[model samples]
Target: MRDIALLAILLWIIFEAFRRPWIGILGWTWVSIMNPHQLSWALRTMPFAAAIGGATLLGVLVTRGRRDYSQSREGVVLILFMMWISITLPFSMVYDDSFELWKRVMKIDVMILLALVLLHSKRHVMLLAWVLVISIGFYGIKGGAFTIATGGSYRVWGPENTYIEGNNEVALAVVMVIPLMRFLQLQMQAKWGKLLLTMCMVLMASAALGSHSRGALLAIAAMTLVMWWRGKNKFVTAVGMVVVAGALLSLMPAEWWERMNTIKTYQQDDSALGRINAWWMAWNLAKANFFGGGFMIWVPQTFAIYAPDPLDVHAAHSIYFMVLGEQGFVGLILFVTLFTMTWFTAGSLRRQGARQPETKWLSELGGMLQVCLAGYAVGGAFLSLSYWDLPYNLMILAVLGRRWLDRKEWLKEKPEPVIALPAWLRNWFRKKPRPQALP
Candidate 1:
């Protein structure tokens, strides 16, 4: 029954990709329901993601006719270099589990491919938006429930027992959806449809606040400011203001407010001191290794050197530090280049799209992608969400790329005249009409 339900969900997602109603349905069920425990469990044991990938590949093969295997582009080149750095560490270092590293790398690769294949049309883009909104909304609801149940204390969920780390990535994802939702609202005419979209936006904003992530708060603020600036209307301005104000108020919970008041004092304390020490340690390790310390090297090294209690220590909190320590300057360059190109490409596309109203959806998508990518980049400054998280993000990039290509093709195609009549009516003058008398 569970398997059937999962399969049903997957089919619904595919059908929704073509039809678009899935966005509302998914937002209500997945996001509003606020459950991640079940999802986490399924992700751990089932090949749900793999099935999605397989289906995508099959569709691509049938439609496009044969896979195109070519030399690596700048993106693929950077990924390869990063993978190489991961496996070729000079010595037995911290967290040096090559197999685990390979597994993560493969997952990222698969996600990129799946995203590229699935997001091939406007319909697909719409479906992707729905999925993201629904998933993030669900995550937010779950986190909110946990926060409430624990009375604002710490909480974690799932079998892995991962803490609800309250990271900004959740907020980042939600903020990206805002512009797209707003675009849909502008295009839609139905009062109920508009109301539903507005509610989803509220849920997303609420989730961002509930996450209690400082970076998320900051990213959402930045995006909201940009949206307001571009809006050029009182209604949009009002909505943007409300979202910003709500997000700001939510960030100042009593405990969090107190912590902010003592920010300077906290920075001078043991927690901050430890992070500084870790940064220094990571920097020195990178300088010594040059090429890399190997994938999974940081954990064991930290354990061997810094662990007074061995079992308590973990990897460096910052993605930059993690890459520098484990993969060195060379790997860092590749990672940075990959992300930098993506940013530039998305930005350039947005600029070009602004002139073509017909391509507004693509332009909005580009902007959304840029903000989400920026959020990831900023988040990377503090935490390492690059490995497992990279694929989902890259997939979005691929989708954007596909949309740009399709738009170009559309521009090159001849335009058809808009008419109210069907094909049969257009050819009516050439055909005989004998049924009028009988009727």
Candidate 2:
């Protein structure tokens, strides 16, 4: 029955995608974030994402959708980054292992391109935002409730086989979406809708704190500060935030605090030490291999050769070092440049949109996207989620919002068209209105 419902959704989305290309954007974003198939034992093995992706391609191709969509220059940098990694994969220490990772990344890149090609309007951008917020917010709400119930003892986990499968990863992803939730709340007009979104924001923050992840704690603090600074109702929101934080902290067990305390005492923590060694190994790999060691560059051999403590092989937990390890200096530059480009685009679009009354939503969107990116920047420093889908989708929104504002009616004010009065009205007006032409 669960499988049937899942399949039904897939087919419906496929139909919608055929009808409107941007609908496919929502479809894949749902699959990427939610991992719904991972919910049921019966449907656990289903290749739902792959099926939907294939259907999307066929639907778009057959429908000839997005014929007039403008491709932004941001995409070229992403493609270049992907191609560079693909080229350098053969040089990787784990060549066979890199193929699977490469394929996974390629799929994500395909989605990114599809997004750029299809997401043309502000409506599409908001719809995509809704999909992301609701999908991730499901876990956020569930996890927050569970945290309250369990006294913040159990960890929050995402659906299996996704980037956010771990407690820490889910917390970080949850942190990232809070700003989007706030953005939605701001966009909403109805009292009930805004109230509901505000609740979601609180729940998601609870879930992040409940994850008991030290890195997530930092991320939550950073993003919350940014949001508070930019958010309206500063005093009320700040008080509410403090209340929620206090409640969550009181619920958290002592061990959670001890675990978090490792942040200040990382020198004494083995996991922290392992992560540092891994970061060092990445830098060494970048220095040695011009192309870097490709993805998963911190394998045993690389560790043996480069790590300060070779016995403890660890994942490159930092995004900066992860790229440096996997893609070398050139790849790192391209990778960083892509994010830098997105950031600047957001700032530029926000500044431009501020001058226009109609496009103020774009300004709101840009400001919130920056808050989201700040989460990734702070959270990603301690996690190896460089290839995560959420940030990329946010980047796509920033880039598209920038482009759409430039080309569309959102910015340019139109002069109202003059029309001759209707026959009956004209006769009446000619009799009554003689004083209209004031200098």
Which of the numbered candidates is closest to the native, going by highest lDDT?
2
Model 1 per-residue lDDT tens digits across residues 1-439: 6656755766654444233322223322232222333444353355434444444444454554323233224447555765666455445364437556656566545545444433444554555555555555555555545554554444222213222233454545455556556655665789999988776666566555555555455666566656665556969787758965655455445865554344357565554455555666667767777665666665654545543434445556566777776677877777777677776666665676667777666566666666666656664555555554432444355445545554574565454442125678778856876776655
lDDT agreement of model 1 with the native = 0.54
Residue pairs whose backbone atoms clash in candidate 2: none
What residue runs in model 2 are displaced by over 4 Å at the alpha carbon?
231-240, 411-439
Give candidate 2's error at residue 99 in angstroms. Answer: 0.9
lDDT of 1 at 224: 63
The digit string of per-residue lDDT tens for model 2 on 146-224 reads 8888888888887787788889899999999988888888888999999988877777887998888888899888888
Write down the RMSD of all candidates, one decimal each.
7.1, 8.2
TM-score of each: 0.71, 0.90
C-alpha lDDT score of every prediction, in listed order:
0.54, 0.83
